[model samples]
Target chain A: MSKISRRRFMQISGSLVAAGAIPGAGLLTKSSFAAEPIKLGLLHSLTGTIAIAEAALVEAEKMAIDEINAAGGVLGRMIDPVVADGASDWPTFAEKTKQLLQRDKVAAIVGCYTSASRKAVLPVLKQSKGLLYYPTYYEGQEEDKHVIYTSQEATQSVISAIEWMAKQQGKTFFLVGSDYIYPRTCNKIAKPTVARLGGKVVGEEYAPLGHTEFSSIINKIKAAKPDWIYSTVVGGSNVAFYKQLKAAGLDGGKQKLLSTVVSENEIDGIGKENAVGYYACMGYFQSIKSPENEKFVKAIKAKYGQDRVVGDPMECAYNSVYLWKMAVEKAKSFDVDKVTAASSGIEFSAPEGKVTVHKTNHHVSKKVRIGRARADGQFDIVHESGVIEPNPFPKL
Target chain B: MTFRRGNQAPRRKAVIPAAISIEETFVTFGIFVMQLFNGLSLFTILLLMALGLAIVFGLMGVINMAHGEIMAMGAYTTYLTASFIEHHLPGLMGVYLFIAILLAFAVTFAFGYVLERGFIRWFYHRPLDTLLATWGLSLILQQTYRSVFGAQEVSVPLTTWLSGAWEPTETIQLPLNRIFIVALTILVTLGVWYILHKTRWGLRARAVTQNRAMSSAVGIDTNRVDALIFALGSGLAGIAGSVFTMVGSTNPGTGQLYIVDSFIVVVFGGVASLLGTAASSFLIAQMQTALEYLMSGSMAKVAILLLVITVLYFRPNGLFASKVRA
Candidate 1:
């Protein structure tokens, strides 16, 4: 039998009290005063395995809101940001969406990184007629009236990247990804695109999410000797896969490699040296030399830290907030129906570039860029394409 | 479904070899040998991961479900060590691993000692209670790690010496980090075997494990033995975590990836035998590697899990169960 000392009990309770403060902050800011702030939910996974990536997006979202607030928030009212953690679970995403809609009654939500999470939250948004600003690049297979996808779908990102790789890197390609809807659907688009060109998809494989071991996969890759290895391995598993590839003498120098999921943030975790020679396709990179991106980068670094990284997803997440604000101001109301109705054809000169909301579909038209990883945790832009229109349903 | 959407012809069919030639056979044989080397590396990692759980569950009869968090603590220790060395002692960057490895063990050992005194001690003789308590403790520890380290995976810079592989043949390469892990596992396993069998403390610990009341009646400090043994197990896991950063990412939840596999190895080896643990980890690592080489990673995992279930159904006592008068 043992007893927790009073000091220990207080230490535990103190942290619990601190955690209790977040929801209270969201709840207390009801429609009390005449100048009631417009509430927007910033939801993402803040814990669990996916937190390594998604937590950074919350920071980006917050930064966008802060900047908007600093510049005199939309409609002469400050944007009161309500944050929720999805905890890297799909059902939790749905539950959090419902709470943010019903309980908090937030005007709009800019959240979710994985397509699965978007799928989970879709029905809730539909049932409640709530608006969601989803900011992650994903497979293009669906569109909803209640959701505004602020990132590139599969055809915009996948087809262009594969075409570029096929032209420059090699004709024989190998595809690898985490086993999920995004990767599978992306590959489904990729196989046809590779064939459309005079290229061959030499092999394809997927490891489960969070898989750490990849020796045998590397062995198979080495034997196949494909001209280029297209990878979509996600989360912590990417670290193990890249390290093993380097060790097995399959360094990007030996065989060209391009990953859609590996970004500056991932390279930061993977040790830049391991990923330095590889290439990746993304919607944005911190290295993009433009006045808009430069200012956004400066502000982000100032707010976070000197060592903070801006990846594709983070940039898109940052874009999500600004796009939503533009819609709200254009509509001149905080109602979801009014804002969403006035959202189409809204143009924002974002940090990435100029992006325009589609008139028909609720997706953004954004540029696709290919970059080679550098040792300093930044990418060297190798190729940049014109802003491709979002086409969720690409015919093979 | 062959993807011939817009191509001139399927050049793939023309390139397919009619039969396996002699040169291709040699190449296949070479690749097979390289795969076996990979299997050996995987075996070492799994052994290091499982050895600690075996001791706590096997020798102490305490289900330390918080074992993985202890491993995360060690990994974090290593990360902090590297960061400190990089900032304060830039000149000693290459050799910082030696010191980081030691500090990982020390910090986790101390953590384990305090944990046993404060929490696990109360649940002694109640295995199910320890499971529930430790499972809760694991969540708390995970949250603690997240709060302390921040929710992103921190990078541990691998010095140039440990970055690449050792190639003995043109077609075969073994990663240096894996080689280092193999050497570390052997030394740690020997150290553990000696501590449990060659020393006087080992005798008392074994006595306490076999007959706690008798050992207590004969004046063995059963509590002290329990605390030390638990600390030893944690220290072993700490070392495993430190070595893991060379090959994997380190974050608050990094341990969850290996916890289930660690328990599987221990139970499959028979809960009470360290020798059985070594055998089982090797068997599993090789089987998975071999199977993965032939199939997709998810399919290989499914096959291995199903096989383990079948084996366990036949041998519930495990392959090397020992008779102890409890």
Candidate 2:
């Protein structure tokens, strides 16, 4: 038997031996590798600014979990999903992650919306030796042994977006972003890439995170007359920025905006009327028209109801749980070490074509899709960077 | 006489040509037109946010830091209503905004009433304690909202009339939402004015605000007026929040950003006088908006705060304080 199977057998057999003193002692087996339900923990920001995005992830995860459970569960045993709310607080994410890892003793935990929240929970997950499936388009410096990044890496998402903008629009790029580590790092990567790609960084400005006014920034953009705006601004601020941009008469056909973070979900706040015609770069758009994507979309709609909106992060999160299931089944054990070891180079058919887990850095190979906001709060996929390789650790 | 005045204007204009310079003319004209509209719009949102806070703080003197949370509740109400309209009543999304905004006011008003009765009523006189208590309450409300709503932003859909730019000009394209907010503020202010100046409840409320013992002796149920005022204020805040959904995102922690500004407006407006509140709101909004044009938003905020402090330092009771208070 393998070392993991041996450890599992010992652990199971030890627990069974302890339970052998109970009424079911007769049915108790000596083997530790006996059929056991795998318990996975789900932590999410259920009640804060991130909650709107985070709730969809939880729903997607549940849908995936249900599908896996319906298919006789992973490794012939049922899957138990233990959910905990992060409450949108950074410290709460860490606290809840600890509860999931220590108290619940889940096999693997899938959670986190923001980089800050993910960072807060990283040490807890590491110390407890828990596997984490982080689904976010984050600044890709972090390469944790325990994390399996199911979303697009920051460099791939942002770089591909800039390249696409340069080719489609002219080569003048203006960087606009919310003043946060993610946006700052994203802008940092974008500025150099713009220079390398023979483009000019006209005017780079930072708005306070959750800032609403964009008149000044918009005026600066109009004055600078950049070909396309490269925006990394996130959250509630986007609503104000997009509205103000439209209000200030610099919208759609007049001036093209290429945002790294704005997605179908953001369109809800920005209103379709204001957001229509703005280009946003993300891995997943709602309008992907593949048979696999259709089925995935159909399934999600059916599970969450037709009125529910799906975004890139939600799709990645849905894929993450199923990907974990595939990894667990391939390894044929609940042991984190064995599961992780088997996960590397593992391929799973996702909504975004075939996604393969890069063993070295743990990020999945993803397609880069640039979509424009439609009139009805949905995205129209304008460009797709087919099967881009996951480069989690860049030579920078 | 008209021709003489016009002809004299040319001779006088030549004598003091510096006063009629193109740049100075534009500047003055810009300030005059923009500041008037700016004052009106600022008063609209300010009144919406402060009307409820004024009652809560003005009557009970309970420094409710969670008033912003109440506004968030209203914004979420509008979001949910928009969702409902999109789902079940697609044709009524425009009309739904009105219903949703009104519903937000009612719901938050009820919520504020319950909150006042449950916990806030006990700590009426303890301003510092109430401040801490309400701050804690605000945190709890924010967390509860996050737990319920999730972390992602849920946008409230606006009708074509309430979305996008209003003006044809590229230089001065005011958003339709801002227009709607301005209109809503006027209607709300009028409603508040009617309640405070014209109604029997207003008399009792004002009497209680002036001196609680005197109002009670005059057979006015001060307690009832306090509760009603609190609800009215919360409802106004709800309307403000609902209107804000046109321009802002609805989130659990979104309230944190506005509460400080709401308090500043109410305090700077003078605690008791509604007219004082209106004046201060205009001053602050105009200062912030105009200064934002001159400097960065963060720097402008600091400048406005400094201006408020300087003004308040000279006139301790605020710019339009009551003669008795001064």
Candidate 3:
């Protein structure tokens, strides 16, 4: 009814027209075309090392965008996706975010997998007062105004993973990870989390990303004789980690290991024989048997083919886009300022089930699932929490 | 490059696993033996990668950072062959490794030739510039590979021989894939050595490496040899990439992990000397592998690199520079 709202609607509609969402501009001049789609940017490593899992997230985001658009678009306008690859480089991720915001002028961005990368672009997003929807479970120890973390935080992921290991597996845990901000921070948190869970961390070690040898680490684990190996090793390093574990006769069912990041995507590298019986903690698994999840899995397979597998990170990515759409609709506009204010407490039925945005912390209410790797590179969900509010910055 | 630091053997002794009892000595030795085998396995893979990089750096005086991308080309080739075998011939994925090796070589050789003629030819003798340019080219190639192959690593399913572990002792077992890479490395190294020394093409290649201007003056097609040698080098890297899949994952950026060590091998082994490259590959592999067995992977990598730096301090031109010279 107000002039500003009328003009804001027209401006958003004009963008849809420019992006080819509308066939003709004839309706723009008309008095009554109230329906205009919101524009959201999706950025992730589509071609880099993290692509192993990030690719699935990209596809899921696309699928969600298509579904949302088919359902008459978010806020009565088609959801326009501006996709950019981080190329798995930290600086490049920061640069691409600037490009997406300044050049494409997207309202919000959903991107990043690694914490280093998020740290790289955090200042840029914060300074620009832009919203970034990060979808990976991470070693969270920060509270930022510009980012909405739609996945598990450090306390949630590590604490839950440790609780399961302590109760079901063992009290003594050997920790392994690639040396980076996330792994280091995760271990830092694990120290206390393990203590709190009545568990003891027997050994802690780190390897560089893409590292392929694990003999020394295996030997340490063997010597320590821990109840289980709690691994946070990421990327290509994990292949060698699991392989060497198997080669050293320490694979699942023999020498138990519970991984926080290991999922169907990494299992494809570790293979079924090596991954079977290994436990992992995450929010999504291919084995989650819900109607919504079944539809999610079916749609992914239908679009990407039957052999394609979906994982926790992908589901979070999918949910982030939809959550953004929900925020836009609730706000009744695509303006960044309005959406930022409106995003609080916005709820969307994600494949993981109902997720609500934590307005204060910029994290979502996420459930935790502890799954065991089966013989098919798929997971068997063994334990789960009802719903834990996202704890982005756990009290230290 | 064989990084023979004076402190190496002593440091290696420090790595001997602490055995609590006389009975545990056998287990310790078994672990040591497995570490040795692991070193050899890694050596084979690294040798395959470094051989091509050595030739390109030694002969062309260009850094060839895209060497990893060339190897990636081979990896994708292997992926394609595996897919074909899986779909068309079923149960032939094992046999397909041979075909994949050849395909990887052919694709990367042609790619290398094009890269030299189209881009690298102009950037000769400029290591830093070549480094930046080839890095840019690496990005392009990486993007191209990702767009074509999709972002996820396409698993090149190994044959029955390549899968599983060979357990000799209860504690010490050999991964068959590691064994395969080591064996393949030996075969490839011998094959390359034979071509480089025993063949006419190899003679011409050596002549150019010795003195390009003089070789060109003496009725040798030095320019053509440069292109072919570069292509062959790239093809070698491609083979290395193909073999690498047995031990590691092959993604778009997988080539990066090898590039740094490959450079260290080329430079440390007397850039132009294939034998030097081979020896350095083994030594570096042994040191890094032994250290990894003794220390964490990160610390081992740092230790190995420091050893290389120390070696370069003693032998600035590398371990066997004279052999590669006149």
Every model's DockQ: 0.52, 0.34, 0.37
Candidate 3 clash pair list: A36-A77, A37-A77, A37-A78, B1-B265, B1-B280, B2-B280
lDDT of 2 by residue, A1-396 (tens): 556688888999998887776646544652344656678898887775677668778888988898888988888777889999897799999998889888888999889988889999989978888899998888888888888999888788988998888887499988888877888888888888888999999988777777765655665575567899988888888887887677656778688998878877777656777788889998888788888889988998887678667788888998899889988988987888998998998998888788889868899887888998888888888899978788766765
TM-score of each: 0.92, 0.83, 0.87
TM-score (0 to 1) of chain B for each candidate: 0.92, 0.86, 0.89
Tell me the spans in candidate 2 whose CA falls farther than 4 Å from its real position: A1-25, A30-33, A329-332, A392-396, B1-44, B76-119, B132-153, B168-170, B190-203, B290-326
Q: Tens digit of lDDT per residue, candidate 3, span A1-396?
A: 656688889998898778784545557644247655456788888776767667678788889999988988875677789999897789999999998888888889988888878899988897777899999988877778788888888778787788777787468988899888788888888889888878888889988888866766776676678998888888877876776677566778787788888878778766666677889988888898889999999999999899888888888989988888888878887777788778899888878788888868888877889888988898888899878887666664
**Candidates by DockQ, descending order:** 1, 3, 2
Looking at model 3 chain B, report the run of 10 residues with the lowest lDDT sum. Answer: B14-23
lDDT of 2 at B56: 71
Q: Give the per-residue Cα lDDT of candidate 1 at A157.
A: 85
Which 10 successive residues of model 3 chain A have the least lDDT summed? Answer: A23-32
- Residue A229 displacement (Å), model 2: 2.2
Judged by lDDT against the true structure, how good is candidate 1? 0.89
